[model samples]
Target: MSLRAIATFDVSTGGGVGHGLATWFGAALAGPLRGRLEQEQQGTAFFSASTRATERSPRQEYQPLATGWEAMRQELLHEPETAHVLYMREHLGKPLVHVRSSTIRVRRPNAEAQLLFGADCGSLDDVAFCAGAVEFLVAALDTVNPAFAWLGADAPASEETNLDWVLGRRVRDSVREARKLLRGYSWTTVCPEELSVRLGGPGALAATGAFHRVVPLSAGGCDPAGDRDRGGVHRRGRARCLRGPAPRPAARCPAVRPGPPGAALLPRGRVPLPRVTDRKREGARHADATARAVFSG
Candidate 1:
C-alpha cells in the first residue's frame, strides 16, 4: 500500500507563493529530509531529477531537482495557466515522491496549491521511509500554514473520489459551492493532532479563530465505503446527549452518520477545502465555510 500525506493551502496568484514553495522544497530536500534519506541509502542525490509524465509521451527525460524546481517556479510566476507534475524516483516507473503545483486561474476558482509526500510501503524499509516522510510532511504543516490538509493511507484514485469522500460532494457541485463560500474568508493555522482530538477521534476537525479557521480530516473518518449508497454520502443525525457543560448547543450541532473507516463530513463552509484533484482535467476547485455547529454537543 502507498501511504500519502498532503498539505493544501490558499495562496495568491503571485510570484511569491511559487518562490516560497520552491524555497521550502529545496530546503527540505537539503536539510532534515537529507539525513533521513541518507540513512536509507537513498540520499538526496538519488532524487536528482524531476520527471514530467504526459499522455502522448508518458516517458520523458529527467532533469536535476534543482533545475526542475527552478523552472517550475519561474513558470508559476509568469504563467497564469501553469500546471505541472514533478515526481522523483530511483529510476523510470518507480516513483517515490511527487510534487504538483499550479497558479490560480479565473476558469477554476476552487483550486489550491498542494505539497504531497508519498511512498509505497511494500517492506519494512519502505514502511520506515514512508513513516519518516509522513512525519516530515506533517511537521512542515506549521511552516506551510495550509487552510486545510490531510494525511491518509491509500491515495484516492481521482479528484471525484477525494471530494466525495472528504466533503460529501461531487467535483462539479463541490467546486461551485466552494467558490461561493471561499469569498470574504481568510486562512489560519490548523494543528493536525489537536484537530484529531477535538473531532472525538476519526472525524473531520474544524475550529474557529479570531479571523480564520482550520480543519483536519483523518483517515478513519474519511475513508470511502464499498456500498455506493454509503460511499462518501453521509446522513445527518442529532448529536448524542452528553453530560456536563457542552461545547456549544446540541440543538445547533448538525451531525452526520460517520462513514466506515475512510470518510468524514464537515458542515458546509467550515473551512476552505483544497481542490487537490487532477489539475489537467479539472483545473482547480476550492470550497470554504465555517462550522459553527461542528463543536456543539
Candidate 2:
C-alpha cells in the first residue's frame, strides 16, 4: 500500500473512535507546523520560555547563540522536536502532494449516474516525503505523551492504553517505510560527524578562549569568514585569522598581507629589523627576494 494510504487509514480509523479525535488529528497533522499558526497551543512553550529568559537578564551566560547556518543546524540537531516544529513552520501550508482527491460517476438504482469520491495514488517520492512528514507528527505525539517510545509489543498487553502500542507500531512502520524510500533516492540521514569536526578541528568555528559573535554581512560587504576584524588570532601563527581585527592592507602595508601565502614573504627571523652590527650584505639579498615575492603578486 502507498504511504499516504497507510497514513490516511490510521488517521481515519484513529479519529472515528472518539471525542479527542479532532484534537489528536490537529496535533498530528499540524505536527511541528504549530508555531506558524499564531494560535497559543500551536506554538511551542520552548520559544516562549527562551524569549522570557533572554528578556530577564540580557547578558545572561546561559543565552544560546548560533554563529551561522551550520551552527544553527547543529543546535537543531540537539533538539529534534524543536527542529521539526521549526522545519514544518518553514514549509507551512504547502500541499500534502501525496493524496489526490477526485469524484467519479457511478451507476445508481434510478438509472442515473451519481458522483462517488475517489483518490489518486501519488508517486513514491511523494509517499516518502509524506512518510517523513508523518514521522514528525508521531514524534510530536510521543512528546505530549511520555514514554510513548518505550511502550512496545513485548512489554505487556495490559500496557496498551488508548492503543499506544498500535500508534507506536504505526510510527515505526512509517519510519521504516521512509528509510526504504530514502534509499531509492539520494536522501540520507544527517549525523553529528560534521558538527564534531567543526567544533574540534584546528580551524574550528570557535577557538579556545575565543568569543564568536555572529553578525550579518550585508551585500557587497567583505565576507565574514575572511574579515580579520571579527576573527580571533590564528592559534599557530602571529597573524590574525579571517574575521579578526586585521587592518585593511592595501594603502598601508603595501608589502605585507596578513595571512598565507603572503606570510611567506617575511624573512625567517621573528623580528624583521636587525642591530646595525648584525645587518649584513646577505640580509640585503634576503630582503631583495622578499620584496620580489611580495610586489610581484
Instruction: Score every model by TM-score.
Output: 0.45, 0.17
What is the lDDT, from 0 to 100, of the residue 259 in candidate 1? 26
Q: Superposing every Cα of model 2 onto the true structure, what RMSD results?
A: 27.5
What do the candidate models score in CA lDDT, each in turn? 0.34, 0.21
Question: Whole-model lDDT, candidate 1?
Answer: 0.34
Q: Which residue pairs of candidate 2 clash? A: 227-243, 228-243, 228-244, 228-245, 229-244, 229-245, 230-243, 231-243, 231-244
Clash number for each model? 14, 9
**Candidate 2: regions farther than 4 A off:** 1-16, 39-134, 137-297
In lDDT terms, how accurate is model 2?
A: 0.21
Best by TM-score: 1
Q: Highest lDDT, which number?
A: 1
Error of 2 at 20 (Å): 6.6
Per-residue lDDT tens digits for candidate 2, residues 163-282, read: 122122222332222211110000111111222232342233234322222111111011112112111123222222211221222221112212212122212111111111212323
